[model samples]
Target: MHRIAILLSTLCCAVTLMAQPALPPVFAQTDAARMRADAITRFYLAPVRVMQSHGATRPEVLTRITNGQTELGRNGMCLLSNAEGDTASITLDYGRELHGGLRLTLGSSSRPEPSLVRIRFGESVQECMSDTRNTKPCVGYSTDDHAKRDIVVEIPRDGQMEIGNTGFRFVRIDLLRTGVTVAIKEAAAIFRYRDLPYVGSFSCSDSRLDSIWLTGAYTVQLCMQEFLWDGIKRDRLVWIGDMHPEVATINAVFGYSDVVPSSLDFACSEFPLPRWLNNIPAYSLWYLIIQHDWWMHHADRALLERHRDYITQLVDQIDLTVDSVGRFRANVFLDWPSSADKAGVRIGVQALTVWSMDAAAKLCRILGDSAREDKCRAVARRISSHIATPKKLRQAAALMVIAGCMDAGDMAERYMHGIDGFSTFYGYYMLEALAMAGRYDDAFDAISRYWGGMLDLGATTFWEDYDPAWGSNANRIDEIGDPARKNVHGDFGAYCYPGFRGSLCHGWASGPTAWLSRHVLGFEVVQPGCRTLRIRPHLGHLDWAEGSYPTPYGAVKVRHERTAGGHIKTTILAKPRGVKVITDR
Candidate 1:
């Protein structure tokens, strides 16, 4: 009887052990996160721009304002006046785009007279001078009160002011009160952004790609303020869906910065249990995916430990939404223009859930929480089993491949052959999925076709949404066969809601910077903080390519060239000591 009891006990113990999942491999802890945070804080100082008004024009003021040669500091003075008939306007150009606070020191007049002043802000030259009443996305402020002393008008903290630390390259200060002399002293914009070194660099045979890379890099830089904003002009708030791609691009370009973790924490804290992030279910999953990417690239154990409980609770919330059949029931938001059907959205959600769970499982293992990790893997398996007909939705299919729900090699060929419905936003992930599937040629072609198309349309910076059929003219309705309109107003969302609508320099659309550096130049992070590196150079159709990726310790420089005999030669110019570089053909 004792022997029989022992056998039963052993069986029970084996069953319990089998039910539990295996933990992830142990990784050594480091102070990289703290060090990065400190470095970022020290470099967070914004470059100031102080410019005086030049000559003014009636319609297009693009030619009037030039960047002042004077040094930016307090107590600077510039006189802005009208010809005595029309509204007095002075345009100030900051040279490049900036996202930060604007301070205009209004010089107090010696006379005891009250004067009203109106100030307008814009991200473009036309936007700066355009009438705010018709302009949909116009940002400006007007004040009626006049003080005897210098008065500083700021974007109020109570949200009463329309414009604050927003994105702008030009400012039009209009004197509203006629015949009132107002001396403007110290017209300065305090630029605020996470001070990150330009560690990543890229140049190739294609000058257009180089230009696109620089433009994309600038676009991403403008969006990196207190948090990862969608755009500088509009919706300057953190949306997890937009943030997923933005964060990836930031990682490749800026390396690991404190803004990323702080942004994640802010998103998680703002939206508690049961509420979807930014009211989108996929956004919530994207939060987890971003967390996984951060840990994988930076290897910040302290970050994982800091948010362990919050991560567990978030995973629990996700678990509650999954049905027995592996279908997700929540708000489904894929991308703009809404191409995906109901079934396709469900499949996309399922794939994203699987991806997030996989990430959560790794995170849980890293945190030494076997129970949640096991649960995450089991749920991911269940969801993966139900993902049928991934090809129905291009976004869904691409995401499935990215999430490891489908074989990248098999899907890459099939998906790359027909990429009919892809916007700039979703195109970012599509390129990533293509690269993962080893379809380097297709990825290159897609970038040339999609992003290149945007360039052909005279896009100085990447846009929020782009349709090839729309052609070079954004105002025309060629797809619908309607008569050409002066401007595409009355469109949905940011298309033309306000005048100067649709973010011209969107951060999420800056995927080519990350793709080119990580894939084409082949500077990938194998271990967190780049302790291990993977150098797989795929210079498709390019004679030569050179770039550098920033690491915690230093920059890793690489140069690749195709030999005359059709052999590819690669050279690592510089890299951190003790870092592993795995070269793959």
Candidate 2:
């Protein structure tokens, strides 16, 4: 009886171990790769804020302060007195939104005694002044606790000190000591980002387009920090879905930066199998697509070779999720407004799966692995065969075309015509599909209507999502109405995201910069590092447009003007020597 009981117990234990899911293979980073990543991190130092502003709570005190000029000889200074109350606050603006640490030069008074002060940082003026209860991620420092404070230093001293990093365009300094005053001789923000040189420019007859391009470029720059954060304000992590569009835009503007491969490596290394990156399955697929993009533009063979085994593991993991019916069984995330439950079975996810498989095949081919390339292509073909009908959404249909699952002409007419339920994030893929289908006229119109609509609403930088009908009201309630709030700048998210939760300056929404520069200005990379350039200028309804695209070698400048006979007069202003410039009219 004892021997029989032992046998049953051992069988039960074995069954329990088999039931547990398998973990992904661990990717070991070589010492050389680790050193390379560390070197890249060290080379990309953050920039300093060149501008500043000052404001006070009291109207009279605010008016009394002068706008400090950006003079060469003197640093900007603002004084705070305790006449109003025991605590007085001064607001500082960095001119543009940024994510970084703060440094302030505090001037000492005649009194030798030290005084305590509290400083709060915010990404917006309203956020800085708002009560702590209302803010989600509140950032403030108190001198009372030296160890717990953001910056570890003595207060009320005539010296400069550094505050910890945060996402902010505004800073509020509160004087805590009664009858004590302090003069802020100088204040500046150390802007953190991957310091890549700007190599792209776009200008046109419409000054609004020019402003929009630059604003979008700046938004991209703000998000290109340590690891391509989704945005500066909130959820500042490397989300693969958001990084897809960001990587494309970075290719056109920043050229070949190490941040791209570093971000990809971080995602794959951090998230193992059976658990998707960010717990979203579609995001993992997007990461695969981004790897293909990195190879095509930057052509970093060493990086791709280093991550080959890890990439194969990811491809196999995704393949396992597909059943006989060719549907993705894991969590499907389309966009912000999409429903996860419904998106799981939707055609969008299937299309993305096929796209990812195709991308994997391309990467395998680049790596000279013919056997793996053939296997990937067979799987992609099998999945593409199952996509008989495309989803009604523009993003799904667009991805179908881009992945070569369907004829571009057939799907373009159905998806590209209407703007209903169109979002800026998905709009990026839709615009690319329209341009790829030889529909430059339609692509140009979509750009003007969708992106130009944002400009019409007085947008200095692109928004996370925009609808033309929303019209001057930032508080417009979305579908499934939650409790309405007056003067709220963002749509509600049912406690998940409260009032004014939408990011005003999002990174992925800045697709117009890439669209205008690549499609409209007709600058494309035929080979990685732009060894071969393709300039096919499409001046649709514009009098003229000119831009310069950065390459691994140098800059390639091009200009196009519409002639009276409806012909495009193209001119190549500058190009690197030995580089082939192919102009297609």
Candidate 3:
């Protein structure tokens, strides 16, 4: 009953059932709607609040930072002007998580020499407030790896210094000098981002859904720096597996950015076969899937053609690993939670292989390699024959459904039962699986409750790992660590992102954005390169919704409103050209 209808670029209905669905959501409020920002740019933001100040002559010194006064000397704010030996520190809240560093403009110091200071960048207020101490497995801790969250630097007298080069919303500055007083000209957040246009967008009658869509878009946008990183704070690398949802988000919003293809290219070169992408067997499957999804969106064969040899070879290599039976013998580590369940992992891995092989067969056919296509189809059929039980695990079950090895309705029921425990990485598939079963309400509610939970936690960007139950006794990320309340950011994480090391802005968690765009606004690519689309509106609860779908021709703006008689009145705001759009009237 729910399909997010998108506007058609109307041309001709040339494609059929072989087509795939579109993805995710984005509403940059006004900025996203108006794509003005450069591909990669920076914006300076001043502190909204001064959390702490020690040994300060002027109590309101740093508080005046909101004025954005970068004037050197004169009545400029003096953060710390201590004659006696005292630990002078000032913590600032930039109000939101951003991908950049801190910039401090020094007016003039009492001493002619440079003044040494320690800068700590944190995704959470609690993380920025603390030093690199008390790091344990389960307990939270801070470090300066990949991107420097903590660093010590010197500010030359009457000069400017930009320090951090990571993702952070809070900054802690500690003065290490006794007699020297440093006057700050300006201290602002150097907000860095790509100048790319927010090509795709989604906004419903619900504000919560709007924010969730925006947050997911912004999260992926932040991760789209030099490459499509998994997270900005941690796991700051081009992880092939994590890029699946990210690529979907890119398709939904940014539309054909080089980051996706470049990162995919990097994944191919960086983690070549035999090693498997990221040394994980499943990640290799993700690589193929990414190519397929990218093909569906931009329909650029250059990527497929560039990695032509590798694609065929990878499929061949995968075939060698399979035995006479369709059972994938590899211990497919799907995700941390799914991996814990070995049997579930077996189901997920087998289905995922079939899914990837399906993509490979199509890709091979496009490349006009019928021999390879036939081989891929045979392999997929064999894998499809051996279906392992999902063991009620939602991720595995979702994977099974997506691969056509399991019934979507059965998996959708299991998915709702354990709504709290969904893999951010695989949540996209779960939503897709739910939609496949015609459970649009289930998918919609899932996206709202789960993805919206992050927004409720005062998250400007999504986290690497999340559990709705975690917010029960958890402190908001914006707030300082309250001993009375649970340390939300500092504590409560498992596997790779444990404790303070957990990334608050992971792109993998941004699946809901794309999910909303595809299922809710419904601009599915039934043909490669959006040659043909099936536009359906699945607005379950919302009265009205409107958004644009990014396509090769241009943005197709579509709107859906509920009539008094409980019927949807659909309208195509923009005119079409080369593409065909199919709708259920």
Candidate 4:
């Protein structure tokens, strides 16, 4: 019944607004739809007015709805009253000024249901007093020297006040000595306020649900005014903490080693994982590259220059271990390499590390710090040269490079051979890395030939393993029918071990999809100041995907759509600012 009433009311308001083209009558309009329309109109129509008033001998100033023909905070206040409605709210902008201290009083000559009136700072809304249902006041929030009320009072319909109640009459506010500042749409609204040494009134009303006023502007303005330096500082802090936790006491070593500080002893070592997996310090090195990429985006020159040496030294050690043919033997045993024969060098580690080194080099150039540029160039040359060699290990290295393990490339000829690729989760790993490097063409090929073939079957998400011909065991291995060597079990499929395969439906993978839809296809709409938005369409070959993320400014929606010609068109809609639409891309 309530939903039906709301729909009918909305229809009536639409008719009313459509029939007559005039500024809305603020009071007589009782229908909620008309109220909403009025609110929207007020949002776009008003020529924002800023008022500034000051006490002649004090540091205080008055701003917002002031009398005396001077926009001063003194003697300036807004009047909100209605004779027949349940509630009344008024919206005003105090600009950048902090209203130091003030008092709000209710006049006796007003007719409303309840004698009690609610006064709320910020945006205002209206309610019907005819409905007796009401909620209790909210709990209080405490700051250093003040405990401001966080509740608003509801005005009762037909109650009387000394001030005239409209739809039919006039009302006024009397402001005493108070300090305030006002500016008109100069920037986005920052809910942040200055630290006042003294106490001040702060409150919010529930009526805002029915009225939409300065809320949009406030959110929009805040995001537009964000400082770039903050991003750089945050990424830097995360990197430093991850690299130098207090538990890892050694500073001389690039990362945690099996022994303390060096290979001398284990008493003060920073090995957090198991002893057998002791050489896994590469994980921290991987994290450093990710953080450095963010820092580079914000152009943190000093941090980039300072840390470039450390990152370079670390990469140097790993690179030196690679043989003349460009393969590093695995000393760590934990990672699955050659069916639990842990000593065999794993291709995944080298691939990931090379990618990190390439990124560090790219960042150095971006910072314009050429100190490590030559070294990076030399490494890239050596890696390329080594991959070109005909040795089997070099061929694997070449495959990793072509698959975005080192620098991103568009080579489709190299793929891990028939049986091993699917069982190892290498398909997902390669797909993600290649996508990261923007090698969409090559990535799509591998996906279509391998992973997509499995998705076409009845699989809901990705699985750990996939075999082109699982039922057919005609091909012989070692001339013996060993069940362990046969790929008949579901767990033994290639997709099983890979984290990305299967319908895992996790947040981490979803984040990557959002990035692709938002950045690659680039259909997200951007409002100048508002933080929230609707999303554009995203098209990919998989089953439907959806992601909603929160930013400092507001929320964002990313969606995808897959089409012919290997095309994907994405749409991004914003509910707030911080989710930026990269216009240049």
Candidate 5:
């Protein structure tokens, strides 16, 4: 009788608990709004313009391409008719960068013979028009790595075929062979992206800066795939160091995103201790900094706790590389620009190591690992004694400033001058170091001038690497029909990205978006979890600026304007609940 009563009691309690609503986990963890494969929504969009057409390429096909949709009583198909040994092709400009593939709905063909089709997806008109194959005549650094932009396939007499799930702004479809006419009922670029609201925003007196800001944000937006990728066009992998600026921008814009933490955790899992991230020394160190940067904004202890074992071991492993005097024992590699400069590369790595240690110390303190915390701080102190003079490399100079091995104002004057040695990857740090010196105006101009240079060339998104000199004689990627002009997409880049293999839509280059939000609006997360914020508007040359910053609680709206007397005015348009806003006028 006693056993029966106890069993009934347990059953009753279970039933009661089951009746309640679903509750979050006990630990304070950010909701990993996991996007499953089914969550991938496709937006089929038609091309805006027929960039080029050859050999019976009819313009009326654009309307009939969408099944059963015809402007007139014409046949419901894009007649891709070609002659023997000759090809008929049409290049369509979608007008922007897309992350998905092309979907071609096919109708009945004129002949029983299967028509051969060649599809080329390009980030530019130059890329789409050029042939990219090992045996092809047109060759250089143009490769289909991470994405198969160039492809050849056969179209059935009655069915459709789609090719590519890559980044592109243009699509060129060619109908190959004779005695066969292929009718493409529809040709649509399948645009896939996470359906997330952009809680963060920025606007200013300068329209150019505003365009750059939004463009940068959109660049990172497309990169938020299964993982936070370095680029959508190429190098579509979770590069830890490359994800820093991306994470910062995500925090400032999206407020909180599952992709950030999940990507970090994924990188930690993909490469354990004794293995550097992306097989680069500094990238492993970047993982440490990413943790702190995310924790400060999201404050998800549960997510941080998930990487407890990995984080501790990684930091400990990094500590072993440092000697008593602060030099790194491991191979020092920072970025492509300074890769040749062995001395500069070593200094950059040392500074990055120190910067990582500082970040690790904080992370360990949060995880209650006091022993590792002390060890990180001790190593940081030892490295601080060593000074880094990054003369020509802006990447190294910026790292040195953040690592406290160099002064910001001095570093700016010595290394960074008029877009000299400006890299899209480390550009944010240079901007941050400038902000550290309170030279917000110069930073503002740097964004306008350097990033503006890309905008001037009709770039919808930023590139993996850029040189202002490239634009001196380069034709805009969108300004098609000038074969004699210099092709920016095909002509520049070095290291991993050479010539046409260069990624035109790189997430690492989206630093200006985060820089504008952090420095111009001056929205600093002074405390972890965004419990407090410090907004000190540095309008610089701008007469006024307004923006919204995302917080865990809610989005904070702010506007700043300069008075005629030169006195700056700041007004808090809106504040989230439980978030304290402190203004530094």
Candidate 6:
């Protein structure tokens, strides 16, 4: 017995000595970090606001605030003062040296609003006069692809000025420095549809209208008419609403609709989305982490662990109440504050839940916590099993995948109602999930149906809403429009074609099309920050489509060539995948 005990002790000591030392936390690679930053910026595209008809009817001053003269400096603010009559001075200040200069755009609406304007600046400053001829009027049905060529101004020293003959009705100054102020000495021009339904309402205490306010209202109608139309652009399975200007502003200022409770000093009433219309914080938190991981192409285990307890506890409490079908049985009918439960028990909720668990499991594996990994895996399997097989559920879940893969469980055909489908609200999601799941045929059929329908409608830019076939209540707007409120698409002309006509050339919906142009056309972006570049491309329809875009890294161009096989062979200008490639499929 003594000999056996000694041997056991020796073995234990040897095993302990053989263990490897802990590895230090490796910060994300520079390229990865750059990619992540790019994704983050794109994911949260900053909305630019400007005066619409400043020079048309009213006399106004166009101010260019450089990074050096603005109150917060860094071109953070620009002040446009309407002299209240014949003359006005637009003051531009960048305040201090610590602040850097940023680009600002100034322009008239698409319809020419002529005004003789002059540029002036401090003695040390250069390029005080903005070249109105070069400023591309904020025109076009779709501003998504438009360049920011309006008033390109850099904050120089203490003073910069741009004066115009007409009282300006609209002026858009980019946030270049902190406390960027625009004071109009003249009376601002009033909008014609200021009191229409869904026109304008909603903003932070600062009362800045989101760039998408007009677009949202215009698209809301279409979304209601046919869900997938918007889905094609928004990606139903993902949280695209967070990208809207008003939505972003509200969430940033008031706290994300779901998790506002966690943050103190946030008055719930201060937010626009009532508690009843918002999502649960846990959902947002989980989705945020998963999104970060998916787009950034990495798992931050330490970060995950830091929030593990809170996430785990909240999920645990949630699970206790949810039934086998994934419904909150106890509060099934009882709605939470600011929560939207329109698609209850559908794949939308399940997809996020499953994804979060899957992500957690990945983190656990990376952290060398086999036990926790097992736990997360088991939960993931359970959720997947419950969510993936039903006709409606499967189609919905497939959309959640975003890879456009399809499988046996897919029942998109079963849910099709000619014009609308059970999954209409999630167009892009349907394509992505079907692709990821390898349900290529179904995904193709659905895309064809949607594309054909849009073509039939003479759609230059995709609408915000539509049925499975782009038919039905095809109007692209919500019922609410009032100039007093900061509503999307109700009052502004951002989504209008050439900034004059109301139409569906929307920026948000175009993003998905860009993805398809890359994915289906097989075009890949290879540059470092230019992850969206394209070399090889194919378009199913249209004479010839070619366009170049400026990305953080560089420029990308997309071109397509038809082939007999009908499948596009793509060539990437650069390699998008850096150290590793992630295949969710």
Against the hidden reference, what TM-scores do the models get? 0.76, 0.77, 0.90, 0.34, 0.90, 0.40
lDDT of model 3 at position 498: 71
Model 5 TM-score on a 0 to 1 scale = 0.90
Clashing pairs in 5: 65-185, 65-186
Candidate 6 local lDDT, 83-144, one digit each (tens):
33433333332211000112233332111322233332210011121222223424322121
Candidate 6: global Cα-lDDT?
0.32
Task: Name the 10 consecutive residues with the lowest summed lDDT in model 1.
Answer: 141-150
> What's the best-to-worst order under TM-score?
5, 3, 2, 1, 6, 4
lDDT of 4: 0.30
Off by more than 4 A, model 5: 1-36, 63-76, 134-141
Residue-wise lDDT of candidate 1 within 1-585, one digit each (tens)? 223224334643554465444334562345444433212111111122323343232222223222422333213334444545667656666655666544544444322454555565555455454444432333221111110111224321111122245555656666655554444434566555454556778888877677667667767877776677788766777888888878778777778777788777888789876678877888888888888888877888888888898888878878778877787867777776544377777787788899899989988888888989998988898888777856456788778887888888877766667446777788887888888877887888778777877666445557787656555344421111234533322232332323355565688888888889888898878887688989988888889999888777778899999999987799988988867787765
lDDT of 5 by residue, 418-478 (tens): 6677789888888888887778878888898888898888788888888888887777878
Tell me how far the alpha carbon of residue 126 in candidate 5 is from the true structure, in angstroms, after superposition: 0.6
Q: How far does residue 42 in candidate 1 sit from its true spot (Å)?
A: 13
| Residue lDDT tens for model 4, 1-585 | 224224334644555466555555665645545543221111111112322212221112123222212232223223333324223332223322111112232222233233343322211011110111113211111111111112234332222112211110001121221222111111111222111110100111212210111121111111111110001101111112122111111110011111111111121133322321124544433444543533422234454465555555555555565555655543531123233432223554455445556766766566565766556555545544554322233223333664354453432234433323432133434444455455554543454445334333322222223455643552121111344543222212231122111111111111122223332333233432223233443223342333333333444454444546555445454435354554321
Local distance difference test, each candidate: 0.66, 0.65, 0.80, 0.30, 0.81, 0.32
lDDT of 2 by residue, 113-186 (tens): 66566666554444444444343522221111111112223355566666755555556666666676556655
Task: Report how far residue 357 has shifted in candidate 5, in Å.
Answer: 1.2
Cα shift from native, residue 28, model 3 (Å): 42
Off by over 4 Å in 2: 1-77, 83-87, 109-118, 134-154, 340-345, 388-391, 406-413, 417-420, 437-497
Q: Which of candidates 1 and 5 reaches a greater TM-score?
A: 5
Residue 509 of model 3: what lDDT?
Answer: 89
User: Between the candidate structures 2 and 5, which one is better when assessed by lDDT?
Assistant: 5
